[model samples]
Structure formats: C-alpha cells, structure tokens
Target: MTHQQILDKLSSKYLVKSIDEDVARLTYYAMCFEKDHNSQFEYIFPKLMLRWNCVLNADKNTVTDHYRLITILALCIHLHKYGFADKDLTAEALKAIDKLNEAVVLSDDFFRKSEEIKKIISSLPVPLKRKPSIPENITFYREKDVVSIQLGNRFYAAYIHRLTGVNESPVIEFYNGVFDKVPTIQELEKLNAKGRVYNDGTERISHFSVSGMKFLPDLANQIKLISACVEQKPPHQHLEKSVGLYIVMDIFKLQDEIKSIFKT
Candidate 1:
C-alpha cells in the first residue's frame, strides 16, 4: 500500500479522523529523531512498531513519500525477521517486507550508507569551508563502451549517448545504475518548483533548473557534496535533503519508463 493509503487505514482504525493532521504530527516527530535520537523521541518508536509499522510523512528523510514508507517498512521487516512481531501482524506487513526485500534491497543499502556517513560527519570536527573542491583521488575513466566513476572504494557507471551523434548527453540510466530507483526528466525539471505565497496571499510558481549531467557526476562528487555540507555545517539535514532529491528524481524516471512500456 502507498504511504497515504496505509495512513488512511491506520487513521481510520485508530479514529485519528484526519490523515493530514496525523502526518504533520508524525513528520514533526520524525524530523526531531532524524536530527537527534533521544529519549524524548523514544515515545514515537513504540507507537510506530506496535500500531502503524510505517511512517506516513512524505519527506521523513527528505526523499520521496514512497521511500519514507519503505524506510519504515524496512525497519519493521528487520524487526519481524529477527522474530519480533507487532501486536497485530497482517498480510500487509508480510507484503511490505517481501516487496522491500525483493525490489529495493539495494536502495535500502544506499540509504544505510547515507546514514553511516551522517554519523561519521556528526562525530568529526567542523571542516573549514574552503572553496568547493573536488577530491583529486576521484577519477572517471572510460573503458570500451562503459565509463566508470571511482571514488575511494565505491564505483558508479556513467553513460554517454553518442550514437545519435547529435546533442550527445551523458546520463546514468536508472536500470543500469546501482540505485533501484531513479527519477524521470520531468521530475528533474521540477527541482526548484515551489509555490510562493505573497503578502496579498497570492501564490506563484518558482523553480530551480538542474542539469542532467550535473546530477550524474562522478560518485566522489556526490559523496563530497553531502559530506562537505555536513562537515562544514552542523545539523546535517542538508545531507538527507541532497540525497533525497536524487532518489526522488530517479524514482520518477523509473516510474515514467515503466508507464511508457505499458503504453506500448
């Protein structure tokens, strides 16, 4: 079930009456935990595990809504896998576990790395904010038809579409990449898309434009971008936002691709 669907059912059964209100409350609490896991945050854990077994917030970690659900479901599944069942075990719980294990295992690992990096960054002293510098150790090299991006021990694949010989652009196709989800071009176009409410209460759409190749930079740059932001700035929520945006974009792309295939 989608996050909202799960939220709807849970809210109905629990007599919460309003999913929006519940989501807002849950999101606020989740944000607090993401910034710092403390006893005050402990109360929500039991309720989640015992009642919902899910997080309904769209941007719990600043990623897409689906991932917010998956992130919660992964933990729920892990708990169940270790022989800890919730108060009420339903088929939905099993389905969630199976879907995550079968479909998004790699994506789960990717988020796990992001979490590890966040912890490492939080423990380190504040790094001096020098001019944004790309690490020299990182390299992107093409061998045969494949371009490999290497940073430390991690490697990602980059694709250069030159066969058409017209307006060749480098992209990392979602299916060909390490990520289980990728955003569509349409989704990327909405990077800066936000509604601004004016003093008079009128709203206007504003957006930031992100380049295709910019998002497909070498793996090192992606890591550095998040890590540097964390090291230079305390309260590393930016790290989650950055990684979340990439994940959101990839997922949109993947969805669009699947839709097109079904159409044909």
Candidate 2:
C-alpha cells in the first residue's frame, strides 16, 4: 500500500485528531524501511536517531504528540531488529514506551492502547520496489549524432563518440560552448570548429553508463563527422581501465566543471 493510504487508515482507526506533517513524513520513512532494508540504513537511520535524542532532551511538561508516539514506535522496532541487547538502548526504549502508554491513557485506564498501536505499525505492508533510473523503452543514440545536454535553464552540446576504455564502452565528448537554447546540428558543427578547449587544452570527454546516458537527449539527425580542433588524447589516464570509474562524470558534476571552467 502507498504510505498515504496507511496514514489515512491509522488516522481513521485511532481517531488521531490531526496528522502533523512531521508525523506523515516519519510514517513514510517507516513504510520505506518496511519496503527496503537499504533505505532504512541509508536514509531513515540517522533521522530516527535524531528524533530519539529529541525525546531524551524534551522537558517534563512537553506534550508528547502523535509525532513523538510514532517516533517511539519506530525506535522500538529498530531496537527489536538489533535483538535489544544494549542495556542503555533497552532502557531508553522502555522509557519511550512508558511515555507512549502515559500519553495514550483511555477512560478506564484498563486498555494498553500502545500495544495495539505497535501491532498496527508492525503489520504495515511492504511497498513496491523502486523503478530503475533509466526506463526500458527509451532509445539510445548512435555515433556522431548531436545531443543536447541540459543544465538548469541553459543547454550544452555533445555527441556519442566512438567506444573507449579497455572494455570498449561508448563515451560522450562535450563541446566547450554553452547555449541559451538547444542548438541545431549546423550550429553545433560551428561551435565544434571554434577550437575552444578548456584552459588546460584537454578535450572534455567522459564515459557514461547506459543508465546515465539517458539524461542526454536522443540522437539528432545523422550528421557529417565534426573533427576535433586539436589532436585528441585521453582526458584522464587513471580512468583507462573501466567505465565504472567514470560514474562521477554524471550531469551535475559536468555542470559544475563547465561552470568553473568558463567562470559563468
């Protein structure tokens, strides 16, 4: 189920007066943890720790709202995963559980409503897996086809050059010109001949994975070969072994490098 649906069900069943934005976000993160273990480690763990620290420092009179209760339950679940062996962490978990029990006291004081809430959290469904970075249906470009590269409002140009590296992976060679708009094939050819290499005189070329290549616009009409302004050499000798090392050449890094080179 989607996180929103889970939140709605929780709100309706528990008669939660209002859903705070922080509670909603934590619920989403908790559901994400249920879906993928990697997401829990990479994204949710640090945030959960921070929330737990806040609970520790909170004043006695501070209101323990829905957000706090959700945080406590998430912490309890996380501790349960670690086998609950750390004495201090176990004490903190027990303290948080007590706070939840105190905050959730009903009229008769007989119902351990916190236990029911924990059961609901434990039963949240695992969500669908995430989609791939590059969709399967997108077409790839052939050699010498002009492609537009977008960086925020501006556009740049590059083309699918021949295979490089020991593995014979395809590489995209970027030209040294930025455009206010997407340039046509003829305009790109003119830019290519301007002999505008970087200050170090090295041509800007880098390997990209097929997934990373999806960011470049699809191939332009087949055009005549645009020869390099100078003798072309490998941009970085250390990157000769494999395309994996060049993953850092993704678009954002390229944008920063281009901006720094031109001082734009």
Per-candidate Cα RMSD to the true structure, in Å, reads 19.9, 16.5
Residue 166, model 2: Cα distance from true site in angstroms: 13
Candidate 1 segments whose C-alpha is farther than 4 A from its true place: 1-55, 59-61, 88-92, 95-264
The TM-scores of all predictions, comma-separated, are 0.19, 0.33
Per-residue lDDT of 60 in model 1: 49
Off by over 4 Å in 2: 3-139, 163-170, 193-211, 215-248
* Model 2 Cα lDDT, one tens digit per residue, 93-159: 4555566456663222313444543453344334324421221222234455556654444666665
- Lowest lDDT sum, 10 consecutive residues, model 2, at 215-224
Q: Which candidate's TM-score is highest?
A: 2
Clashing pairs in 2: none
